[model samples]
Target: MKACDVCGKKSIIQKSGAHRYGGGWAMRATKKRKVWEPNLHSVKVTHDGVRKTMRLCTKCLRRVKAEMAKKVAKKVEKPAKGLHFCFNKSIQFF
Candidate 1:
């Protein structure tokens, strides 16, 4: 019943086939049932100044981290207020 909060990723049942080797070749194939579970982790995320705990998958976690890093980089790259350069021009009346 564990699922990712961001993408709704959940566990699923997968059907796999097993092959038996007799003489270096597959002799018989057997069907096997297995459970495929998503890697979920409990993480704290802040949204709109509100922090909450959520169950997130690894992919989503990486995406969130990347987004945060991008935001930080953007902030760092911006010029400070009153520190920007401006070009002055003068026009002569004809």
Candidate 2:
């Protein structure tokens, strides 16, 4: 049983309809059944300061990556306290 850790996505059975043609003007419709599997991949994920490997579907993986990127971007946009400087000599010390 293959399933996604993030979204609980699993394999499912699907049916498709097709038309069968016989002698002239005679036709019949039939249902074809097939198994559909989720696009799952093994990925390393960090949660609550612990890193672990998990099986995540593509959609969940994309969401996780986007969230990580947003967090990194927010950190990068902030100015470091040590890098701050003042022009005035007396004020620079405070």
Instruction: Tell me, by TM-score, which candidate is best.
Output: 2
Report the lDDT tens digits of candidate 2 across residue range 12-40: 99876655454443334456789989999
Number of the top lDDT candidate: 1
In the predicted model 1, the residue pairs found to clash are none
Instruction: Give model 2's TM-score versus the native structure.
Output: 0.64
Clashes of each: 0, 0
Q: RMSD for all candidates, in order, please.
A: 7.2, 5.7
Taken over the whole model, the C-alpha lDDT of each candidate is: 0.83, 0.82
For each candidate in turn, the TM-score is 0.62, 0.64
- Candidate 2 lDDT at 80 equals 58
